[model samples]
Target: MLEIKNLHVELEEEDKKILKGVDLTVEPGKVHAIMGPNGSGKSTLSYVLSGRAGYEVTQGSAVMDGVDLLELEPEERAAAGLFLAFQYPVEIPGVGNMTFLRTAVNAQRKARGQDEMSAAEFLKVIRERAKSLKIDAEMLKRPVNVGFSGGEKKRNEILQMAMLEPRMCILDETDSGLDVDAMKLVADGVNALRDDGRGFLVITHYQRLLDHIKPDVVHIMADGRIVKSGGPELALEVEHNGYSDILSEVA
Candidate 1:
């Protein structure tokens, strides 16, 4: 459902290029894992796809189901069925968690011409999903990610994903800084959202998270390009051998 073609992203203030002609495609009902070392431009791919500010699309395009994603604003992209769970979720200290969530949900609904849910109905669904993700009710009333543990922050991102129910979800290190239990919870949240019409692109540094999510395709990215592509077994291989073998090939 998502196609990234010859994508090159560069910082406008500098001559440095972060992504160099990267190409990837993710179809519905599938999960794609991008495993790469630091500075491989994996997060850049997510930000570029989500239309985040400060990243210029110097070359190529990302099209979601034939819609040109670069043409839309960040919120517009979210309204068009795209979600990015950040590697480091920002903690909006002044905004209540549920207040921010309701605003986000209602904004997307308004964009689609759908009727907004009442507070009662939205609370019911959020609570149910939060329970499934093992989030506490008290946690929902506080400021967004404020004073939350790493695990709780991750779960909160997953909760937002569940509420949004986007067609394609880009998880940018959702597994980062989590304990084993928290990682499993994050993975389960992602798996629960899987459907015949939904797809996921999970970016991580290791295969441990893949063990939980069970990706359909595993890609090894190096130097801003996909150096190798394989099935789940490739993830295991990387876990054992590291990126030395793959980076050599790409080099």
Candidate 2:
């Protein structure tokens, strides 16, 4: 459902390029894991696809079911069913998590020409969704990510993803800073959302995360390009051999 072709990106203020002709396709109902060392532009691909500022797409296209994402504004991209779960979710002081979520959900609904969800309906749905992510009501009452731990922040991101129910999900370094148990909980939360209508691009550094969230396709990115792609075995190979062999062969 999501296709990225020859995507070249660079910082808005500098000549340094982060992604160089990166090509990828995430089919519906498939989980694609991108494993790479630091500086490979995995996160940049996510940000660019989600329409974050400070970077310019110098070439190529990112299309979701024929919609060119590069031409749309960030909110417009969201309305088009693209979601990015940040590696480090930001904190917004004085804004309750519930309030922020309700606003965002309703805004997305309104943008799509759907009726806004009432407060009672919203509360009921959020509570049920939050419970699965192990989020307590007290945590929801607090300002967004203000005093949350790293795991809590990740869970909150997943909760937001669940509530939004995007068609294509991009998770950047979701396993970073997560303990084993926290990782499993987050993985379970992600797995529960799996279905025939959605696609997932999971960006992670190691294979442990893959153990919990099995990917149908695995890709190795190097020097801002996707160098290799295979089935789940590729992740196991990376876990055992690192990127040296694959990088050299592709080089």
Candidate 3:
């Protein structure tokens, strides 16, 4: 459902290119895992796709479901069914989590010309989704990510994803600070959202996340470009041998 062609990106302030030429296609119902070392532009790809600021797209195009994502504003992209789960979810101190979620959900709904959910309807739906993600009412009542633990923050991100139900999900380092159990919980939540009409671009440094998510395609990215692509075995290869072997062969 996502297609990118010869994408090149650079920092707006520094003029330093980060993504040289990235070409990737994520089909609906497929999970694509991108594994790479530091500075390989894995996160850059996610940011560019999500229409984040500071990164200028000098060349190429990114489209979702035939919609040109690069041409839309950030909120328009969200309305177009693009979601990015950040590595570090920021805290919104004054806004309660439920309030924030409800606002976001209704905003997107309004953007898409859909009727807004009633407060009662929203509460019922969020409660059901939170229960599956193990998010209690107490957590929902607190300010968003204000005092949450690492695992709690990550779970909260998943909760947002579950509630939004975006068609294309880009998870950038969702496993960064998570423990083994926490990672499993996040992965399970992700897997539960997997569907035939949705796609996932999982950007991670390690293969452990893939063990639970089980990508349909695995890509090795180095020096801003995807150097190799394979199946789940590619992740195991990276796990066992590291990026050195693949980087050397590609070089």
TM agreement with the true structure for every prediction: 0.98, 0.99, 0.99
Model 2, span 1-251: residue lDDT tens? 99999999999998899999999999999999999998999999999999999998989989999999999999999988999999989999999999999999999999999999999999999999999999999999999999999999999999999999999999999999999999999999999999999999999999999999999999999989999999999999999999888898999
Cα-based RMSD of candidate 2: 0.6
lDDT of every predicted structure (CA atoms): 0.94, 0.96, 0.95
Poorly placed runs, candidate 2 (over 4 Å): none
Clashes of 2: 0
lDDT of 1 at 116: 94
Candidate 1 residue-wise lDDT at 10: 95
| Candidate 3 local lDDT, 20-80, one digit each (tens) | 9999999999999999999999999998898889999999999899999999999899989
lDDT of 1 by residue, 1-251 (tens): 99999999998778889999999999999999999999999998999999888888889989998899999999999999999999999999889999999999999999999999899999999999999998888899999999999999999999999999999999999888999999998999999999999999999999999999999999999889888899999999899989897787667
Model 2, position 140, has a per-residue lDDT of 99
Error of 1 at 32 (Å): 0.4
The TM-score between candidate 1 and the true structure equals 0.98
Judged by lDDT relative to the true structure, which candidate is superior, 1 or 2? 2
Q: What CA RMSD would you report for each candidate?
A: 0.8, 0.6, 0.6
